[model samples]
Target: MKRVGSFLGDWWRLVIPYFRSEEWPIAIALLIGAIALTFAGVGLEVLFNDWNRRFYDSIQNKNETVFWREIIFFSWLAALYIMVFVARAIVSPYLRLRWRRWLTSHYLAHWLDDRGYYRIELTRAVDNVDQRIAEDLNQLGQYTMTLLLGLLGAVATLISFLFILWELSGPLSLASIGIDITVPGYMAWVCLIYAVVGSYLANLVGRRLIPLNFMRQRFEANFRFSLVRVRENAEGIALYHGEKREADSLNARFIDVFNNGFRVLMTQAQLAFYQSGYAQLAIIFPYVVTAPRFFAGVITFGVMTQTASAFGQVQTALSFFIDNYTSLAELRAVMDRLKGLQIATDEKPPTAIEVMPQPGRSGVATEDLTLSLPGGQALLENLDLPLEKGQSVLVRGASGTGKSTLFRALAGIWPFGRGRVRVPEGARVLFLPQKPYIPIGTLRDAVRYPDENSRASDADIAAALQATGLGHLTDRLDEVAHWSNVLSGGEQQRLAAARAIVFKPDWLFMDEATASLDDAAEATVYNALKKQLPGTTMVSIGHRPTLRKWHDRQLELKRAPGEVGTLVEVPA
Candidate 1:
């Protein structure tokens, strides 16, 4: 019960916002409409119960006029029922979509804000974030609509039918069954007991489904993620001829999915068996209970028929939870995943590194800065470096010696560090990693990314591409393709350099941004930047000795065994 309460608390946090959001008026109105339709449906059921008694009485009496009149009455009732059902079907899903749109946009903002996407990955707090955002949100919307409407309908049906069952049930005596007992409204009490027992048994049979569904979602997402990974790296796998290895890994992931799916199927089968029997038995149990009174002439055939119908309605209303156990389990799983994503995205990282703007500063500066690996091993310690405007510096260090990490710190992304790194106020800074992220879009968009609506003239963009040795792509700016997969590594780096020229930031940090190009091509790219953007300050990480002459000064990171590296000046 405590666990259920906790689950409901989380559910409220997810659901209440939609009804109180800017879209609240429409959402609340639609919800009220849907709810009114639900009760109208219950009203139709009660009307049918009355019609059942009259129709059956006419049959027993063989009265053609009464039978035909009742049939016409039912036609109108059925029409109204159909209308209510159809309206609810349409309005309920519309409500779900509205809630879904708001929820998807809300989560997208949080997941993308403050680099939450990157931090989530670095912390590894949640798995399959893409699946959580895409599939889980969709499931949440669908399941919430189903469960909420089902519950409301159940409550309305119970209220409507319970009174009818109580009024028609009369009384029962157990003297003939070797017991001396009398009960009032015995049929209503029977339904309450039956539903209570059935619900308890259903909960027992299906409790394991909660965790099973959770694991199934994870397993399916894992398998899907593996397939996407393989597709993204198809070129590298083909180059290595690793199809057999890839196939084995993929098959193993599928095995996890299959095994968990089998378990779920088994549990569902158990639940289905119990629920089916319970329902089939309900159909006959009400008739059996009322037949004795009818045979004793204690009631008319109409009374017996009405009593049975009301009993069925009451029982059906009470069995709502039993019928929706699997859906409830599935909803629980989705809620857990979404809650986990929310917590992870909202959490602040523990590291104490701080980056802020210093007024009157012209370039980047680090004071008493220390950096570490994600696992807390020191990478660089107490390294103070001052970079002035219009100066270019090349940073060199051995592989795994924190060169790229230092660049990350300077870019204000590496959070696993301490102390302060300050940059000039209102300065435009850009970081170019070894592999530039080329979003799947047109060449013009890729070259002018982070500025989707760049106003730079085509001629200016074309010149930048030509100067970076990518003149062939100048005319294809509007052609859309997966540019990252289409371009060679050297061409990609040159494209990034072209992007840098278009951006024209005040400070540019490149972490081996030109490693893919040949020395001559790299020199051409750097020299072009020197002649065109002479005021831009540059910090670069590279191992090539040919890169030394482009920078006016150099900082090399040096580390001894089991100690953090320190940055020192070196000759250019």
Candidate 2:
């Protein structure tokens, strides 16, 4: 009971937001209407149970007119039932869709806001966030609709059938059991006891399903994510002839999925055995209990049949949780995933690296900066550097000398550090990583991304592409494709250069941005930047000796015996 209570509490916290969202009016209205129709369906079921009694009694008595009249009555009831059922089916999905759209939008906003996605990656707090937002959110809608409607239907069935069961079932005197008491509503009591015992047994058999379902989702997502990773790195794998290795890794992940799935199937088979027998036995148990009265001439066939129908309805209502145990377990897992994602998204990035925007201040500078790796090991400490306006500086160092880490600290994204980075307020700055991000879109969109909606002119874009030696792509500006996958590594780097020509930022930081290109091609990009954005304060991180001519000054990171690395000015 405590576990169930906790689950409901979590479920309510995850789901209540949609009901209070801007779409709540229509969502709530549709929910009420659907629930109302469900009750109407339950009421129609009661009418059918009563109709069964009269219809069968007329047959037993060989009455033609009454039978025909009851048949006509049943036709009306059936038509109304179908109408209500269809309307419910139509409206419920529309509501689910609307709710899902709102939730997906909300989650996306939260996940993308303030670099929440990046922090989640750094923390590793949750896995397969893509699945959580995409698949689990969809499941939330599907299972929420099914479970809520099923519960409401069950409640209505119980309300409408319990009275009929009570009146139809006479008091059973316990004379045979050597007791004097008479039990009223004996069939209702029997059904309650039967459903309770069945529910207890079903829970015992199915409790393992919750964690298995959770692990199954994780394993399946892990396998799928691995496949996506392989697809993304297909070129590297093919070049290295590592397909066999990747295949083995993929198979290993899938084996986890396969083993867990077998466990789920085995447990489900056990549950199905018990539930199937319980349900089939329920069909006959009511008649068996009422048989003595009917055979002893105390009641008619119609009454006995009506008692059976009512007992079935009541028992089904009471056994709602038992029947939906597996689905409920899956739903629990889905809700837990979404809740974890919500918590992760809400977490703020570390403030260890502080970025301050100083209005009217030109260029970028850092004061007494200390940076550390994620494992609490210091990389650089007490580092101070100041860059004046319009000066091109190149940063060079051996690998593992904290060159890229310093750049990250300056960009204010490396969280495990203590530093103050001062950037001129309202100044546009851009950071180009080694492998540039080319969103799957048109050539123009990919070049203009992080600012796709900016008011850059077409002539400007074409000129920038031509200036960066990508004149061949100028004609394909309107073509939509996965630009990253379609373009070669050198071409992608050239595209990043073209972006800089278009953006013309006040400051630019490049971390091995031209590593993929030939020295001659790399020189063309640097020359284009020097010629085009002369006043832009540029900082480049590279190892090529040929890059020295473009910069006015160079900063080199040199390691001491035991202290963090030191930054010193080197002759350009």
Candidate 3:
């Protein structure tokens, strides 16, 4: 019960926002309309129960006029019933889509807003964000609709039909014990007991499914994510001859999927055994209980028929939880995932090394700067540095000395220590890593990324491409393809350099950007940058000794035991 309440509490957090937003009026009206239609449908059901008694009486008496009159009445009742169901079906899904759209956009905005996406990927290293957005939000909205609508219908039906059932099954005695247990609503009490027992038993059979379902979804998403990662990095994996290892890893994840799925099947099987049996036995149980009253002539076949319908409705209402418990559990699971994503995205930046980029054209400046890891291992501590326009510096260090990490700090991404960094506000700053991100779009857009609407002409973009010796791509800018996979490693780096040449940012930082390029190709690109953008300042972190000629100065990092961070110095 506590767990279920907690689940509902999370669901409310997810659900309540939509009704309170701008859609509140329409959503409320549609909900009220749907509920009214349902009540009308139930009203028709109660009238039909009366018709069952009268129609059965007419048939027993062999009266043609009464029978035909009742047929006409039922035809109208059937049409009314059909209209009610049709109205609900039409209006409910519209509401569902509205709610889903609002929630999807809300989550999408939160996930992508203000560098949350990059921070989570780099800092937390949590995988499968795409799955969380695409799959989890969709399922959360869909299941929330299903559960809410089901609960509304169940509650309405229970209230309307329980009274009918109390009137029909008559005063009661315990026949098994032959004792007078004089309860006015004995049949209602009987139903309450039966429903409570069935629900309790069903909970026992299905209680483990909630966590299992949650794990299954996460596992499935993870496995799918791995497959996509392999596809995206197929060339890298192939170059490393990692197909066997990849297959083994993928198979291990799938095995968990298979085992979890099998467990769910077993559990559902257990739940089904009880549910189906209860429904089947329900067919005869009401008749058996009221049989003595019928034989004593206290009621006719008509009453017996009406009484049976009322009993079924009551039992159906009572058993709703038993039937829907599993789905409710899954609904909660999806809610939990969305909540997790929200929390992960909204977490405050670490207070230690977080550097804020200030607005200036004074060039990149840092005052009393310190950078540290989240674990408090200093990358660079108590360091002060200034680089202005036309200054090119190379940051050099042994591997794992946090050369790249300090660049992240300057970019305001690695926020684990205390520092202040000042840079030109609204100044175009670009970071080109060892491998550039090739967005899946036209080559032109990918090259001009983070500058999607830049005023750079096609001729200029084309000339930049030709300068990189990728003249073939000069005419293919408008043509769309996955350029990352289409181009070779060296070619992609050349393309990345071509972008830097094209965008001509005031400041450009490259972290091992030429590691994959040969010495000749690397030198050609850096020399081209100097010729093309004479005023642009480039800070590069590279291991190649040949790179020293392109830069006027170098900041080399030193790491030692018992030391927390890298020490930086400007070489003569």
Using lDDT, give the best candidate's number: 2
Model 2 bad stretches (over 4 Å): 559-563
- Give me the displacement of residue 440 in model 1, in angstroms: 1.3
- Give me the overall lDDT of model 1: 0.89
Q: Rank all candidate structures by their lDDT, best first, as comma-separated numbers.
A: 2, 1, 3
Order of the predicted models by TM-score, top scorer first:
1, 2, 3
What's model 1's lDDT at 548?
92
- Model 2: residue 81 alpha-carbon error in angstroms: 0.6
Tens digit per residue, CA lDDT, model 3, 152-244 = 777777887788888777677566688756668677888888888999999989888888998888889878978998998998999999999
* Pairs that clash in candidate 2: none
Residue 571, model 3: lDDT of 58
**Among all candidates shown, the one with the greatest TM-score:** 1
TM-score for all models, in order of appearance: 0.97, 0.97, 0.94
lDDT of 2 at 247: 97
Task: Give me the runs in candidate 1 sitting further than 4 Å from their true place.
Answer: 177-180, 560-562
Residue-level lDDT of model 2, residues 1-572, one tens digit each, is 89989999998987889999888898899889878888888989999999999998998899999999999999999999899889988988888888889889999999988777887898798999999989899889889988999999999899889999999997999988999999998988999999999999999999999999999999999999999999988899999999999999999999999999999999999999999999999999999999999999998899999999999999999999999999999999999899899899887645477889998898789987988766666778877799888888899988878888888888888877787999999998999999999999889888887885677787888998898889999999999998888999999999998898888888999999999999889998998988888778899998788878888899888865345788889975
